[model samples]
Target: GRALSELDSGMNRVQAMRSYAGDQLNRADRLESDMKDQALTQEGARSRAEDIDMITALSQVETQKVGLQAALQSYAQMQKLSLFNYIG
Candidate 1:
């Protein structure tokens, strides 16, 4: 009867240890999933901040080019007028 009681106690300890191990494994899985979600969120934000919209950038460049061309033409015209006139 004593030996049988000892065996029951040992089985109970083993079951408790298995339950603890399973809880630890579940916690680890939750933590890993949370980290992965955070990493993906950060990646999306970084892409939004760093990635330029090509069409918008191209339109801005074209607008600046047109403005510069207009300014150059105006300056050339002023130079032509100034070169021909003499003033004290």
Candidate 2:
């Protein structure tokens, strides 16, 4: 009985670890998606920068900064929520 109980406990831990690893993988995928979006936005801005004047370039840079800030904030919030879920 003790051996069976120990085996059960080990199996539960393994299952929990699998769940945790899956969550980590999901988080990584989300971040990769976010990075792709940002990269596209940056690429577009770069393409425009070649033809645009200084003022437009500056404006686009500011827009990019705002977008980046929002993305970071959103990522932080998601991380916090996921952590809470995992812990609680």
Q: Best-fitting candidate, measured by lDDT?
A: 2
In the predicted model 1, the residue pairs found to clash are: none
Q: Runs in model 1 with CA error above 4 Å? A: 52-88
lDDT of 2 by residue, 1-88 (tens): 9999999999999999999999999999999999999999999989886778998778999999999999999998887787669888
Q: Report residue 54 deviation for candidate 2 (angstroms).
A: 7.3
RMSD of 1: 14.7
Q: Candidate 2: where is the Cα deviation over 4 Å?
A: 53-88
Number of residue pairs clashing in candidate 1, backbone atoms closer than 3 angstroms, sequence gap of 3 or more or interchain: 0
Q: Give each model a TM-score.
A: 0.58, 0.57
Question: Would you list the C-alpha lDDT of every candidate in the order shown?
Answer: 0.94, 0.94
Which pairs of residues collide in model 2?
Answer: none
Tens-place lDDT per residue, model 1, 23-56, is: 9999999999999999999999999868979899
Residue 25 miss distance in model 2 (angstroms)? 0.5
